[model samples]
Target: MESPPSVEIISSSFIKPKFISEEANKPVYLSPWDLAMMSTHYIQKGLLYALPKTQDFSITAFLDDLKHSLSDTLTHFYPLAARLSTVKQQNPPSFTMFIDPNNSPGARFIHSSVNLTIAGILTPTDVPITVQSFFDHHKAISHDGTKLSLLSVQVTELIDGIFIGCSVNHMVADGSSFWHFFNSWSEVFRSGTITRPPVTKRWVPPGPDPIITLPFASGDEVIERPNYPLGLRVRIFHFSSDSLAKLKAKVNSECNTSKISTLQALAALVWRCMTRARRLLPEQETTCGMAADNRKRLSPPLPETYFGTSLHSVKATTTAGKLLHHSNAWAAWRLHQSVVNHDDKVVQEFVNSWLEKPLVYTMSRYFDASCVHIGSSPRFDMYGNKFNLGNGLAVLSGYANKFDGKVTVYPGRESGGSMDLEICMLSKNMKAFESDEEFMSVVTY
Candidate 1:
């Protein structure tokens, strides 16, 4: 590990909007299961880069200063950073929630800090500099500040570039919320003032209100047969423009099908592709878990100020053979049925009931169970138009972990009569997808 920069703090302050006032009304405690679910994803890192040579800021100091500056915003979302602070051992067991349960909630966000490291890059000039790695090296599995470290001194280099990696708990904030924090941090650093207001609406803790829970389970499948991976896998491929055009045209023109979104068509194709990869029989049901942003879809559009958690998941299934047999028309219709009006109560109930069952005993039993976790956000294209991260800079994207054979399908360019499809799958599945002439021809132009 490398040390952080030695930079002076100009001025740093959080922009807490009027909407977040209510969420601060009380400290919320998530179930140990929810915290564990959140912690698992923290292992999947989100990274971005910064190239600021003129500023007196060192990568190390910038991170240290930023961590101190953003303490207010950090405390506001205490559950995310602090909850993982109590870990005593490396990658502690599931039952051990990280943060000290008895610690005052006020101490929550304040404990969070930014760490740094240095990696060499190919460059013409000879400069030695360090980079900021926000995550704790020791607390790879937990979220403790001490486990988290700071480079004792400033780091400088010839390249004049730094990479910032964020390991925030997804349960605390999605990419959207995370971007808001980033933009605010940039604003405070650049101008020494919090110019823009908080992007999140006031937080509303879901009261004993009857509603859905996350990680919606279906069947006794997840529990009855927990499929642990026999080995790790990776694959990659580039979808050409021509191939995407032809596929969209075929799916759009399929009989008995009206206009179908590229997402649905791609989802079907991905399921088919995964089935092909596993060589599953058409009669066997395969599930692709889809992630949805319930923001606008939720009634009253869920408070803009309300932050906490604001998304949910839905699962759809079909026999591999049955899906394979379908013409574009039938598959599109089936895909539409699974996702359209997903906000409806019936769909929510369908997902929640499956997860509520006490299946710890069952979930522990299986390994190598096949599942495709799919998440695609239309917002990825919009460069912070609404969230307003400053300087016209935004990283508008999110994805499920490469584990569990995930697929993310979102809107693509309009080709022929349909929009282009962007499909991201685990590396291995991607290779299988690219080699499938049938799959490639239809989607490409």
Candidate 2:
């Protein structure tokens, strides 16, 4: 493997929101959903942009514009400038947690650069870039509870373009809220105005506090990152529109249903292929934990711009051999059914079912060796954001999802039906997976 590139940080400062409502200046409690992620890793979402190639580039001006616009953008996203705090009521016990807006510390704004260029990071041939480079190296964001700011922004200037990255507290929001903030940032920077005013109304699930009862790890408990069955690897694959159409057709025809969705087909294909590559025994059970957006599904639909988490994490299970040896359509049908069944009521039930357990929903407990965790989704229109700085945003590298046996799906760079699939797994499994004939048939690596 090649050595990681070097990056330099020139300056750093906190960017405060230009305006704050009187109500937003107080402490905001974490809903049951927010409590579920208290002990987990923060979600780091990175955007790689190929800025409009300019013969003359002004670093000073660029930094000023970015910082100024970001400050303005924060006006509508005041919670991001807030800090996390734990409340204590007694000795052997705990108290409800809340976001202390009164103690809000402005978000960190970093201006950095790397020796490399956009072309060097994204190749015309194989994998453009590994997200670990952004998450692990040149790290400017910290998620530790010690950090006062719940959000951080790092803008790296490459030779030809720029890389815009944001680190956000998962406790404050999920993937939906994460992107919503970014889209708003881009809009403000490009046009000096926010097209979508952020909605801060958090979804308070109908449940008691300390959402999940599963036993959370004690402060001393240590869970090492997964690196077994040979070291791990992360790779990105592009699936063209034609390929998705083919899978959709294959699934629809075999299942005798015309409503089979693209996501269902893709999920089934990846799950089956991964299980086959692992060569699990017939009786060995494998599972998939997927994140579902429960926004519109709620009885009183969540506002399109509701700026909080509405993710209802759900799972599906079956024996390894059954998933692989069974008809592709069968697996696809199962996946489709699983999602279809997880309606609004099921979303609430998912939360209610977990209210009795300790907060075991930490990242360490999210996925096991036998299960694959699928987060991120094609539904997020990532490329739609016009990062006014570029020669038309060329490619979106991706967010950093460090865990093994994980997959994140983003909108394809090409047509509407396409997809950019990022798969992270053991190195041995990746090699076996890359060689899998069925998987490679429709994928462009």
Candidate 3:
């Protein structure tokens, strides 16, 4: 049998911000929402771009320019270069993030190379597990920010392409912020400036005590390495614009309502198909948890450039029998209601509950044979990150934070409202899901 691919480390170093300010060095208290993700894994994702075809194209020059732009980018996104510090001395430990200019704490940058082709990485029926090697901090969780770099980047030089992998502490940023930093880096790389600067001021709930204290006295008490299930397989399923429109039309027609959105219809289809593929008991309960972006949902919406985690998980649930027996529109309506109901009031209420008793997210929270958790919005501009090499051929999720029943949605490279669902599930279930006719019907890839 052929051995899996391997990555040879060419170089590894810390890339500090080009400039720092005393204000940027001040400790910024983590909000309750940020504290909630302390136990989760770092957000790991990367973009693959075909190498430019030009006699002047020089890999060495390209990499040097990329690193220089990243340094300049960090000047604006300095918080990413900071460390997560725990105030263990406090009665109940408090967390704060700050950059120590004197110590020169910086984002970890790794340069690596792999003897593989772009097709070898993207043509497989399943996402290559070897892709995990393209990222740093595979075993590190968000809380490890105390000792680990809050942000780590690995640029892997492929035979005909380049894969830029990024791992950001989940407690420090969400999908929105992740993409913001990525886009900013690309902008700086190509144009030497950004259109909109990131808002570094972290959001705090309006109350007597803005900073919510953790129940634990030390980071050790809260840090946990979740044991994900074994024998899992991940595959990307593509849904074209026409396919999405057809799905939305079918569900809305069946329900005689136009309220179900394309996302709702798509979620409903996955929820029902996975339930059938699992072959669960008829009466067993099934749940679909969707990560709702609360930036706009909150009253007096935060800036689009807000640089921190701002997400809430909303769930729609029903018995497996009911889910399978119901019309596609019925399931879509359930998901639609769950998402639309998460308004400002709900967001604030969840914050209040977290303040009363902080609860860090664990993989087990959503790990269940009967549960599906969907994250990463399809609305994110996955294909627009050019960085002078042109649009990405594909966007990939790393092995970190992966568990059975986890589904991450990304906009297709083809754009025009198309979407790609990166689904992770047990090997057995994946085999069944791949053979599922209804699910495969809309899948373009």
Candidate 4:
């Protein structure tokens, strides 16, 4: 086996936004979700983009541009450049939040170059795809309750392309907030200004609503982290348009009811296959959890461009044998129904359910082996965010998923109807998972 590509940091600097006023340093209160997220130093979300060739933008020139644009963009998105911590008090505090000060620490930006190319690594060949090796691994997930830089950008120059990886703290922003900053930064990179200004203030509950609380005592956190360290494996699975359609049609037929979305069908298929691989009991309760974006779904809706975590998670649960024994459609319908249940009334109820209590969520925190999480929506332009590079986006992957049974979905590299599944599982489960004939039948790559 060959070693994966390595990243050598050429230059590391702190880029403080040019516009942060003294008042911008005022302590910022954290949302309930923020506190819950801080409990486990869950690995930061990573994005690897292979940029097209550029004649004018040399590796140095590109890094120069990235640094300047990112700094400018962070001005409007200042909280990103701020630190995630609690107000220091002699008596200790109940909640942790962002520490703000004029000279507070800024995001860490590293300029790196790798002796690899997008073609060599991304395209499968003799060696298996060890994508996690080519990313900013340690700085992203190594949290010991100190040094809370909200964002870290590592721009590596590859032989034939540019490898851009972002390690963003979940408490800093969820998918919505992360993408909002990304889009604005891209706009600043290409157009010198952003179109949609950010709405950084958080959304609060209605009048008379009780204050929400969350447990955040680090080591004693209720996070569903692995009880013991286990070696993990990462693999990329592809689903072609034709195969997805056929599976969707078959699912709808078996469901014997109204149609469900392709995502639901896909989730059900993967969940069932994984459940069968685990060989859980017929009565064992297994869950499939997916997050719902509440940008526009919640009452009154969030701002036109809310730059914070606004995700509401919903799960479909069933007995292991019950889910496995039924037709794929039955499982698909369960997934769809879970999403359907995230209605306006349920959205409010979700908030109320966490009042004066811990804000528990299912993502990387599902403690048991019976849980399977459906990650990053396929609807997200994961691979389509163009940097205005000539050849455009060639591929996209979240590269650093460490949790077992967690799958992150992305758009296929080639185009329409194609999908990429990055499945992270323990070595044992992953070994058995790859050989599962039922899953291999529909996979295109």
TM-score for each model: 0.60, 0.89, 0.96, 0.86
Model 2 off-target regions past 4 Å? Answer: 124-143, 146-148, 206-230, 391-400
Ranking by TM-score: 3, 2, 4, 1
Report the error of model 3 at residue 79, Å. 0.5
Return the top candidate by lDDT: 3
Task: Give the per-residue lDDT of model 2 (tens digit) for 1-445.
Answer: 7766767778888888888878678766666667666555566767677766576867778778888888899889888888866544445444555677765568888787777866676664334444334432122222244355688787787777777777787778888888888888878888889877877866665545522222332322322322223365667788988888998999899989997788888888888888888878899989877788887877777888888767776677899978877887888887777778888788677666656553535444566667777788887757766666543344343333455678888878765788887787777677888889998997965
Q: After best superposition, candidate 2 residue 94: deviation in angstroms?
A: 0.9
Clashes of 4: 0
| RMSD per model, one decimal | 9.3, 3.3, 1.6, 3.5
Steric overlap count per candidate: 45, 9, 0, 0
RMSD score of candidate 2 (Å):
3.3
Model 1 TM-score?
Answer: 0.60
lDDT of 3 by residue, 1-445 (tens): 7988799999998988888877677777788788878888899999999989988998888888888999999999998888877554475455443323335459999999998899998899998878889999987888888888989999999899999999998988999999999989988998999998999888999878655566676666666787757899999999999999999999999988899989889999999999999999999999998898999998999999999999998899999999999887899999999999999999999988887877878776556779998899888876778878888999997778888889999998888999999999999889999899999999998
Against the unseen true structure, what C-alpha lDDT does each candidate score? 0.41, 0.71, 0.87, 0.68
Off by over 4 Å in 1: 1-25, 31-39, 43-45, 50-57, 75-81, 84-161, 179-231, 235-249, 255-259, 347-369, 381-400, 408-431, 439-445
Any idea how many clashes model 1 has?
45
Instruction: Please list the residue runs of candidate 4 whose C-alpha ends up more than 4 Å from where it truly belongs after superposition.
Output: 1-5, 21-25, 40-56, 88-93, 99-102, 124-146, 207-229, 359-365, 391-401
- Candidate 4 structure quality by residue, lDDT tens digits, 1-445: 6777666778888888878766566655555555556443434444455555455656667778888999999888888787655433333334444535445568878778778766676566222343443344342432322464677777767777666667776765776677677778888988889888788776657655333334444423454433323575666788998888888888888777656988889888889999888878999999888877777778777785887677766799999989988878888998898888787788777666665566544334454688888777666555544555543443444344346777777777665777878787777777677788878888997
> What's the CA error at residue 383 for candidate 1, in Å?
6.0
